[model samples]
Target: MEPASETPTALLLIDIQKGFEHPTHWGTSRSTPSLETNVASLLSAARSYNESASQPILIIHVHHHSTSPSSLLHPSARLPGTETSAIEAADFAAPTGTEPVLTKNVNSSFIGTDLEARLRGFGAGQLVVAGLTTDHCVSTTVRMAANLHVLGDAPDGEGIFMVKDATATYSKGGFDAETVHAVHLASLDGEFAQVVSTDDILGRVFR
Candidate 1:
């Protein structure tokens, strides 16, 4: 196993927001198990590794926000008197001081956000990515990872590493789940990112 600090890896947890409770976020009308279990397991595994690792894991949680009128994700939206937004507290379980959250309006975490700068600040060369909608935010972030240059002038760019089981997508969307899931993995594997699993990742860290 590579030394943790020397490895320069970070976990990219994207769009785990509570607003996804409805299908509107996925261009649908209802939610599915994708929002509940798969991503939850990944988060648990990540937190476990963080607790035991010699070097603390750097977690960058990406939240989606919108300014568009009538959009549920609009910046003016709220869940009542609470300061918590759906993106703020939903499906969130980060060890205090370990995960720094980044809010974004775009699908790609690198686009219109401080994600790239924050990743470099944490010295992350490899990214372990997980989150909602296999066809959307998760996929977009992975794509951006492949082209993200450490410095625009640098020859080689930092690559994206995707955790397959760590991600989930709603089943009732306009697209078919089996086909959409398979295609995303196939397209991402090798060309843009390396598709992996939660166990595959934990094995590297634990043993």
Candidate 2:
């Protein structure tokens, strides 16, 4: 299951921050109990592939920071003393210094960021996306990535993939989090992106 593009591919991690992990603040059940472990595994594989690949695999980290002080995601709301928003180090598979970190204020990473241009600049024709909130930020970013016309080509299915096991969202209203996660995965599969497990990605796509 190698990606369709011969050009370099990127591992795009979206919104894997600490604020989302707070059960009291975020209030969501995960699709998998091993979400952090799976994400770490996939990230390790991506790093290994990047080191060996001649085409240069880029690892990009996308995080969300609330622009408004009133927003729950605002650093002031989460940690009073910290002026900067940070990825939750306890849970995050930390990125190397060479990897670029992109911050976004909106659900779609591309809306206020240069992520699309940066990917194109790196000659990345395909992307594997993994991160928090399967039905929100992760889903939104994957859809935008799928729609991107890289190298003068039309939007295609090969452009992006969603790592199912590596992402989780909180349950909302009466719907369970697992159900929400599954429904979004189903919607994206065969359309915006291929929904795949971390093992599938590591064994097939990254290998």
Q: List where candidate 2 sits over 4 angstroms from the true fold.
A: 3-7, 70-72, 79-90, 150-155
In candidate 1, what are the lDDT values of residues 93-126, reduced to their tens digit?
Answer: 4434657778788778888888888877776656
lDDT (tens digit, per residue) of candidate 2 on 36-60:
9988987887777777676766788
Q: Which ten residues in a row have the lowest lDDT in candidate 1?
A: 150-159
How close is every model to the real structure, measured as TM-score?
A: 0.77, 0.87
True-structure Cα RMSD, model 2: 2.8
lDDT of 2: 0.75
Worst window of 10 by summed lDDT in candidate 2: 81-90
- Positional deviation of 67 in candidate 2, in angstroms? 2.4
The number of residue pairs in model 2 that clash at the backbone is 1
